[model samples]
Target: MSDITLPSTPNKLSRYEITGYILIAAGAIVLFWGIIMFDLVTLIATGANEEVGIVFGEFGEFIGGIVGSLWALAGVFLFFATLTYQKREFELQRIELHKTQKIFQQQNFSTLYISFLNKHNDIINSLTAYDINKSEWSGTNFFVFFQEKVLSSFTQKVRTKEESAKTPELLHSFFKDYFIYHFSFYQTSLNPYLKNLSVLIKLIQRYRAETQDAGEYYSFITKAGFTQSELFLIYHVARYQLLVEFHNIDHAFDVFEDLKDELKVDRIVQQELNDENYL
Candidate 1:
């Protein structure tokens, strides 16, 4: 197998990368305004517009959201350029990846992996969810809804539970039961995507152990270009202990803030979950 070239620290800025930097500048400006704007913007009114006062009162939210969303877009722009560069850089490895086909399958494993990556959003597109008001959502809106309505609510639910009740065993069962009952279709659609992620990670580990060619093959797996919601879902999936094929997923998380917190379960509960006799 070829030494799969990882993304090096990019030296040249692409057009979008430049745009992203400009947006960073814009966001800094907006953030400054967000800090002082309630007083500054209102003071500019000079009681002339009076601005309904309530309208001016929302300067903070308006400005803050603009700044926050601005930064998110900037990051996306930068990430796109990085992905573009990495794609070109990894061309050799993709060809060499054909050698693994005998093990992964008889067909071209490189094309197979790329196809799986391409279909990720298609799976996300197939995922349907109803918001609190029964509004059907898919695609990007689906991720936002899941993060805001689903994960946020689940986080609060965990907070409400006693520490002793915070075990992976209980949480896993709870989420499985709840999601199966409510988001059964969503669950069904997401399995292939998640399974692919687990498979890709395991494949990288297998390649590493066998080849001993220390290259960043993991980035090939990370090329799925996870949306924030997708990342959160992966983290939660592992936390809930739902994925049996999943391995080496922890490395994909980039040491998320709640990485340890999610697994902080009661010792007795931990023992129980490990005991196959109880299962």
Candidate 2:
């Protein structure tokens, strides 16, 4: 048989609240009784005129005064005790409200993070496909290819003296077509990727601002169920994309390093960094 656990019901009244109510009720009853007794003593002292009756009246008045004073003191004590209990209840409610607000904020952050991860995954998938095509290209080889094949070839052709007469026409047509193709490719491929990266960066920045702790933020994200491999992928892709878009590889690397450390995925991140296929 499966074990069944029932949900515990919340208390309608806290101990302090119950005590407060009790004190208030007791105080009111004691005050009322004191008023009645004092009134009775006053009636006796006023209505009686004989010496014996007067003496008895005086005695009753003295005892009534003492009793009334004691009751008043008790009422004052109860009043302050009830006030203290009320203050405590308010403080407890404030604490609970703060906890609820924190939970709400976490839910919001989780939603944003999931959306950001989906976008990041799309870009990562595209890059992975491209990487498969250039499986042998290392960071050094990739840069060399860009310099020699793409940049150098164009520059040399543009600067050639042999084609000086037709240079303007050739340059115009070649550049027009070249730029169109490249721009179209970028628009189709990298634009959405970069936009998603920008959004994720902004979200992380906002979280960091609110938390003021980089380690804690990363830890929270990992604990939210992101695997180490997934985190490594995010770190790797985001770092390189930031480098491509901003030309700030150093800062990108620094940020990824910090994140990996905080996520405690340093071993996985280091292995990827050491891989020859990594850029």
The candidate maximizing TM-score is 2
Which 10-residue span in candidate 2 carries the lowest summed lDDT?
Answer: 139-148
Across residues 217-268, which tens digit of lDDT does each residue of candidate 1 receive? Answer: 4554454466656655666566556677644466643424432332233322
lDDT per residue as tens, model 2, 1-279: 122243333346545455656655665676566547556556556665675475556555765566455555656665776776667677777767766776787789879888787766656455422233565433223222322232234445455635434444454444334333433443455456556765665676677667554554543453353334334434434433433543442242244433445332233223323434432
As a whole number from 0 to 100, the lDDT of residue 142 in candidate 1 is: 72
Question: What TM-score does each of the candidates earn?
Answer: 0.42, 0.45
Q: Give the C-alpha miss distance for residue 242 in model 2, angstroms.
A: 9.2
Candidate 1 achieves a global lDDT of: 0.61
Candidate 1 all-Cα RMSD: 31.4
Displacement of residue 152 (Cα, Å) in model 1 is 4.7
Q: Provide the RMSD of all predictions against the true structure, rounded to 1 decimal.
A: 31.4, 13.2
